[model samples]
Target: MIGFMKKDIAMIKNNLKVLGVLVAFYLIMGLFGEIDMSFILPFMSIAIMISTFSYDELNNWNSYAATFPNGRKNSVKARYLTTVLIILIMTVITIILSLFISYTLNKSIDLEMTFLNMLAMIFGTALVQSFMYPIIFKFGVEKGRIMILVVIFGTVIVGGLFSSVVDLSKILNFLGVFENHWPLVLIVSSIAILYISYLISLRFQLKKEF
Candidate 1:
């Protein structure tokens, strides 16, 4: 399993030059007023996972991996685990940066609330990936890529529209009912979503063929 993960990481690192360019550009724009840094984190997380899955799908790396001792299940597990690990690390780093920026700028950002919102965004993105990655694994990247884009873009558009019409800011007031318990609720809900997504991905991977 470690070997499988190493190979995937190696593939990601080998493309570091390209990845670095993207990350740097994102950081610059985020640091500037080009876009809210908070908005970039989940998108970047989703991008990394998609890139990993897309790379495997396009290269048929799993087919080669299956010839090893651990079999296809390990290959799938390695990919899922690696993707989750990367997302968590990236999310943490993004949170720290965003907080630092908010503090320096003296913006009225609530660190805890922002953190929860970021987690919610990541969870939402993962939910989409959980459903798509298996299908991508089963089919080839060429076809799967189209569907993934549609779902992601469609979701974003709908979400933007919904937010425009309905003020989600009311969540803070609604959540005020819990008062001191809000943190616990946020943490528990985030954990539940993470676990559910992982289970879905695992089940999907188990059913997938090389």
Candidate 2:
């Protein structure tokens, strides 16, 4: 398991400059723009996760990995693990920045709302990955790239429809039920989504021919 994780980390290390640029851009946006940093973290994390697939496909890494014991399973697991790690790291960074912004700008940051948004993004990212990885595992990266755009636009359209159709008061009331427990709910739901995604990816990978 550790080796699999290290393999993913090694892949990411090669893209450190890209990651740095992304973080820098987001930091600038968070500091200057009206947008919340939490909103962007999940999208950034997903993009990074997808790029790993691109790297793997480019280098024929998955085909090479198939020769190792339990390689396919571990590769899928590594991708999921790497994504979770990235989300956790981003959450920490978001918290620190929220604090810094509050202190420097003399504005009060709503820590609870920030946390809730972070949790929502984490769950949203997991849900997106859940739908994405299985397709990539079965279809390879080239087709998977097209699916990525489909997933993104599909999500946006669905979200727009949901907002337009749903009652704002009812939604707020539903959220009110969670009140203090929203974080726990988000954590549990996100973990469940990720586990299901892992199982789906594993099934696809086991049947996939490199």
Candidate 3:
């Protein structure tokens, strides 16, 4: 399990130059401009991980992995573990940078909103991975990429139609009843989604021929 995780981290390490460039750009934007560039790292880490899926497919890593004992299961589990760690590390870095930016600009840190933003980022990144990994595992990355886009577009259309007929404000108001517990709710739900997504991907990979 640790070996598999190291493998993924090793892949990311090879991309350090790109990651450094992104961090440099993020610092420049956040320090000199008013936009909240803190969201960049968390979201960009997801994109990097997705590209790693492409590398895995191209190298037929899963097929080779299946020859090892419990390789498929460990591979999927380790990938998710590595991905979550990356997201968390990126989020933490962003939070610290956000603090510097805020304090530099206003002489104070909005710790509450900063934490809230990080929580939202964690949930959003986790949600995207949960929705993406199963498809990538089942269909391979290339086709799954297109299918994911289609699914997202269809979902947006359906959600738009639903919102047109439904009073979403009421739903928001009801949810606001648990305002103080929003962080806990999001953290729990994100973990649930990631666990479920891992299960689904494991099921697909275990039975797959390659």
Candidate 4:
């Protein structure tokens, strides 16, 4: 698992230039845009992490990895671990950038709210990846890429409709009820979702023929 994680880290490092460009673009937008878009940072970070599947597929890495003992399960575990690490790193960066932006704009910083929002964004992104990885494992990357886009756009449309149809005040009130325990709730829910995703990916990998 450690070796697999190192491979993922190296893959991410190789793509640093592309990720740097994305970060710069989003930072500029957050600095000048009316609304805070720092959440997009973690969102894009997950997208980048998922793209490793495409890279591995293109290089036939999965077939090669199959020769190693327990490679498929380790690969899935590594991807999940990589996603968690990226989320943590990007969340911290988002917080710092949000604080800097607020300070520059002479706005009040709501650290608790900002942190909660970041966690929500990370959770949302991870949920998407959880659904995505199983498909990629089952179908290979080319078809999986199309499915990923479908999943992403479907999520956006569903989220937009849900938000529009839901009562905002009720949602706020529900959140208010759990205000003191929100952090614990978020952490537990995120972990549970990621573990379920890992299990799904592992099952897919086990059944896949490399």
* Candidates 2 and 3, the one with greater lDDT: 3
Per-residue CA lDDT of model 1 for 130-192, tens digit only, reads 667665765556787787788779989999999899878797678778877655665576556
TM-score of 1: 0.69
**CA lDDT of every candidate:** 0.68, 0.81, 0.89, 0.83
Clashing pairs in 1: none
TM match of model 3 to true structure: 0.95
Among all windows of ten consecutive residues in candidate 4, which has the lowest summed lDDT?
Answer: 22-31
Per-residue lDDT tens digits of candidate 4, residues 1-210? 898989988888987887788777766877788766777778877668867887898899988887888888898898899989988888888888888778887889888788889878877887777777787888887898898788789989998999899988898887798778877887888898889988988888888886
Which residue window of length 10 is worst by lDDT in model 3?
101-110
* Clash count of each predicted structure: 0, 0, 0, 0
Give the TM-score comparing model 4 with the true structure, all chains together: 0.83
TM-score of each: 0.69, 0.83, 0.95, 0.83
Which stretches of candidate 4 lie above 4 Å from their native place?
148-179
Residue 193 lDDT in candidate 3: 98
lDDT per residue as tens, model 3, 1-103: 8989998988888888888898888888988877778878999888889888988999999999888888999999999999999999999888777777777
Better-scoring candidate (lDDT), 1 or 3: 3
